[model samples]
Target: MIESDQNTVITKINRSWSVLSSNPIEFKAINGEINPDDNSYHFAIPVVFSESEPMAAVALEISKSHAVNLSVAMYGLDASDLSEDEIIDVCCEMCNVFSANVCNSFSGKNEGNINVPNKLSSEVFRYIFKGSNLERYYQAENEHGRVVIYMFDPCNYYN
Candidate 1:
């Protein structure tokens, strides 16, 4: 096997794990224990693919504080699960807004840069991105390819 230095994926996952393990009361929402709202935020969940077709995509829904309204799916060699209006950004650090409280969506496609449109409402997002399933939600190996774009009520370890 090949061993390389630490990377961004590892960082995001590490932070996400901390988000879950820190306090069960805080991560209870992932287990459906608590209903996420405008305050609740989702961490971890990531896409696992490059410019190629993904094997599977998994998303964690938070009832308390979720950015995307309805789930979405992208297709083709160049497709995305993100909205067309939601802001799309990139990150080099670990645990970015991708999981915090901001009301948005995120992906980890490593082929090229994935851009969400601009600022589409959740309602428009549902209809525009509607598909069978999101191809870049979260996976095992590919999960690390994602980056934090937007968030809401996130738990910052820096604090």
Candidate 2:
């Protein structure tokens, strides 16, 4: 994709996050590589760009504490008694929402379908990140923790 297209996609991704979070969230495109924190939760979902043709995958890496904080903020849930699985589920739901938002933004471009979100091990996320061409890498931070969003093109596993 060209630079303008990349910017449009990044802007849409940022807007999607802003729409999702009750708290302020600002996403900036990163200039270099990023190492996912060991305590972070990772996820990816496949998106079909044009009627059964898979084009990309969107991934997220967010710290554990941030996941809990986001769950509370987004769902008004009590985080005090939340389990790890519950937190992961919330993150997965957020990923699903994000993917849907992105797909809608590109609706004119035949981007319509998004598959189920999958919780990924850090190792698996890293492996995919290394092998794929990253179309965008964006990071946003709040008082809770950090979140990184990855948009990869020519999705290897999906395509």
Candidate 3:
């Protein structure tokens, strides 16, 4: 995780929103000017952050954005049953969900947008990082009405 500026954290979501609206795919990479692929990308998220801990902050954000607590959501994510392309498409759905949510959620406040939050809470991310395999993932048909993503780990392998 990268170091986070206190002031920027609040603005971070908004910045991500602007970037997504303007360029959904590349915004995350260039916004923070990070390497775009690696552990650091974890730090790109701004929500559910810790006061002085970048790693914890990022972890929290990922857990929230990914809705790790929604593990039940992955109930149907079995890789054996899906083709590689289907899995990739799933991941894209997840990305788009998060991306658009961030943008539409905070579209006006400028306080770091993430509009797709349906009763989102920080407690949502408070879980252990149980590495996921295809069979373990599931999708929740949140009111957002978007498809869930089961991607090829784009955050870890950019380009």
Candidate 4:
């Protein structure tokens, strides 16, 4: 991705988070490894061309506490009342929404097809990203907790 495209992706990501949570979020570009904790939740969505070929993907790694807080904010439920499955569901929906937004920005209005978000283990996440070109890595945090967004060209994986 070029510099301007990277900026657009970051802007869309910030906008998506703002739309999702009422809490204020601060995003910063990060370097080095972006390994999430073992307890973190991982979700990924593919951005596909009209011909159904994946060109890119967006992956999200959010802390467990952040996921719970997001669920409480989204569903108006108490944290203690939220189950693990409920948290995963909410996070998956979040991944789907934001990844769609980012993919639309890349493929133009209504031109990109965003696949369903998949929940994965950290090991799987790392395996899929291995040897792929990481276009950007960003970290966002607020009172809720931390979230890491990874933008990458999956096409490079098969190169």
RMSD of each: 15.6, 3.3, 15.9, 3.5
User: For each candidate, what is the lDDT?
Assistant: 0.26, 0.75, 0.27, 0.74
Per-residue lDDT of model 4, residues 1-159, tens digit only: 466866777777788777776665866767787655567888888777655454677778898878887888888889999988999999999888777656655433345677788898978777767756676678887665689877776634322
In candidate 3 the C-alpha lDDT for residue 116 amounts to 23
Clashing residue pairs, backbone N/CA/C < 3 A, model 4: none
Q: Pick the candidate with the highest TM-score.
A: 4
Q: Could you tell which candidate, 1 or 4, scores higher by lDDT? A: 4
Tell me the TM-score of each prediction against the true structure. 0.25, 0.78, 0.25, 0.79
lDDT of 3 by residue, 1-159 (tens): 132432233254345433323212111212211111121112122332223322111121222223221222343543345553443333334444554333223212233322222221323321112221111111223332212212111112111
Question: After superposing candidate 2, which stretches have Cα over 4 Å from the reference?
Answer: 1-22, 50-55, 104-109
Model 1 regions lying over 4 Å from their true place: 1-110, 138-159
Q: What is the lDDT of residue 100 in candidate 2?
A: 65
lDDT tens readout by residue for model 2, 49-97: 7755557888888878778877777667788877778888889988887
Error of 3 at 59 (Å): 18
**Model 2 TM-score, all chains together:** 0.78
Q: Of the candidates numbered 1 and 3, which has the greater lDDT value? A: 3
TM-score of 3: 0.25
